[model samples]
Target: MKNAKPDLVYFSGFYSEATPFIKQLRAEMKDVKFLAGDGVKNDEFIKGAGADAEGAYLSLPSPVYTGEAYKTFGDLFEKETGIKRDASPFVAEAYDAATVIIRALEKVAQEKDGKLVIDLKKLNEEIRKTELDGASGKIKFDARGENVGGETPVSLFQVKNGAFEQLKQ
Candidate 1:
């Protein structure tokens, strides 16, 4: 099978499972292109696979740790945690989630008879009506409580020189 090599090999699993396959494939067929799922699109995968991780491709929602919009959050997070970590898609999603929840609560919470009362039903309605420009991008929900546009923009990246390089298409 090594002699009859394919042009592309794809791995659709977590970094733990994909890294070993990448390493084995690197030893067997160094030139074949490796495509992976979002699970292997992190620093841990690169660290685990070493040089064999280079030139590998993966697709992820949103740009990782890029764009001027995320500079403040990234800087503050690094300063507070003292841990420099790659900004993954989850970070943006989390920010948007928190924003939506807080915004909805603010709209539904009321001071009634010297007591703070929150209407749960109203909060849900507010959440469905949420529209805000977030670090990830514009966030708006449909009646089904899903992002109006369905999925976020997916960007393709290639591992180059031990770092993720976004491929502009």
Candidate 2:
């Protein structure tokens, strides 16, 4: 393989599996670029691959709560859990999902003659019609119950100087 000149290579596997391959291949082929999936986007991959990870690229759905505008939620989470920002990509998405569900429940809840009643059918419909600004950007569902509108951002990052840096458009 050293005689062959390839510009790029793609690795698809969990970090544990892919990191060793990346380290080995990078040692042999210094000029080639490596692209990986979301599995290798964590700290373990960087630590395992060491210097080989530099210049590696990976792309994944952008976690919407990392920006300056979302500092309040980030601060609160860190304060409560003692976890730093960007520790998990799903935190903001989970929060947004819960918010959507709560909003739907509120809209579908009704006050009877005296007590509160919740209709499951109406709650489902309300959930389908949910549209709001959430922690993970705008939350709007299509007929298929999939997010269809607003900024669904994908981020492309490169490992540089032992850290992942988001590339500008």
Return the lDDT, model 2, position 12: 83
TM of each candidate vs. truth: 0.73, 0.71
The clash number for model 1 is 0
lDDT of 1 by residue, 28-48 (tens): 999999998777887788899
Q: What's model 1's lDDT at 131?
A: 82
* lDDT of all predictions: 0.79, 0.79
Clashing residue pairs in candidate 2 are: none
What is the alpha-carbon lDDT of model 1 when measured against the actual structure?
0.79
Q: How accurate locally is residue 147 in candidate 1, as Cα lDDT from 0 to 100? A: 79
Candidate 2: C-alpha RMSD after superposition: 4.7
**Model 2: number of backbone collisions:** 0
Q: Compared to the true structure, candidate 1 yields what TM-score?
A: 0.73
Model 2 residue 9 distance off true place after TM-score fit, in angstroms: 1.1
Model 2, 46-73: lDDT tens per residue? 8888998999998778745545435766
